[model samples]
Target: MGNRLSKIYTRTGDDGTTGLGDGSRVGKDSARVSAYGTVDEANSCIGLVLASELPDDVRALLVAVQHQLFDLGGELCIPGHAAIFEADIERLEAQLDAFNEPLPPLKDFILPGGGEAAARCHIARTVVRRAERETVNLARHDAVRPEAVRYLNRLSDLLFVLARVLARASGHGEVLWNHERRKA
Candidate 1:
């Protein structure tokens, strides 16, 4: 791990270049930075969902996910570094299985609206998908771990399932998209 930050304003990035953990600086618009920023955005979205009322187990799981996301950010900060572990992905898989087991299978596309917490979770899920796409783009140009990409893909799926679980728990149902009705 890098040294703990003692100051919040380094002013070093005033020129639009940010420093990485490996003492390298890259433009803020670089693919790596974009990937990191998207991940940060997803993390914030998850935080928003966590702010709402949720089951204790789901709350704990999201908390753990936040920590894993921080680890992912740290890994991005250091090129050629492997900070995200397999166990993290495994945990997501386990949670996905547990959460999806009781939920009815999806037969149609769903809209992104429901109870407050569930809706926020859907927003987070989209952000997670964006983060995954950005990470994939970054990996194409940078030396990124394949597991990182795989983890993000899995995480987005987990977030989608979680949103469904949250909706059901809150006495709301899935907002299935009505393509035919809209067309008609």
Candidate 2:
């Protein structure tokens, strides 16, 4: 980990093209770049969730997720390279089960609001889904590790469960959606 970004401004991307981990240049909006960029965006959303008061165990899980997301981004940036694997995806699955086990079963749709931390987790969930979609779009035309997509997909589920957990912990409760019809 030699300060890879010792000089953040390389001026190389000023021409609307950016360098990939393999030293190849592509348009800034290239599908591969967008795919990894969205992962970065999702990681930032998780940062918001981390800044809030939270249960220690949940916070620890999210912190590890941040590191995993960075590895996911690395896998995306460098062609023919991988930093995420099947085990990573399975770890998320285990967390998802552990977190969801205690949550009350859902009978109706829930609004994406509760306590501030839960709301932020909801936001992170949406971003992770978008990252998954972007990765799928990239995969349609290019080679992408299967685990990358699986990671994001599982991450959204984990975030949803974490949100519910945080909401209950905050005593604000889940914001259940109201399906009552209203006359316009």
* lDDT tens readout by residue for model 1, 1-184: 8878878999999999999889999999999999888888999999999999999999999999998888898887799889787887898999999999999888999898779999999999999899899998998888999888888899999999999998888988789988789564
The number of clashing residue pairs in each candidate reads: 0, 0
Candidate 1 runs further than 4 Å off:
1-3
Q: Write model 2 residue lDDT over 1-184, tens digit each, in one string.
A: 7777788788989999999999999999999999999999999999999999999999999999999999999999998899999999999999999999988899989889899999999999999999999999999989998989999999999999999999999999999988885645
Worst 10 residues of 2 by lDDT: 175-184
Q: How large is the C-alpha RMSD of every model relative to the true structure?
A: 1.7, 1.1
Worst 10 residues of 1 by lDDT: 175-184
User: Which pairs of residues clash in candidate 1, taking residues 3 or more apart in a chain or in different chains?
Assistant: none
Candidate 2 residue 37 C-alpha distance from true site, Å:
0.3
What lDDT is obtained when candidate 2 is compared to the true structure?
0.95
Task: Give the winner by lDDT.
Answer: 2
**Which pairs in model 2 have colliding backbones?**
none
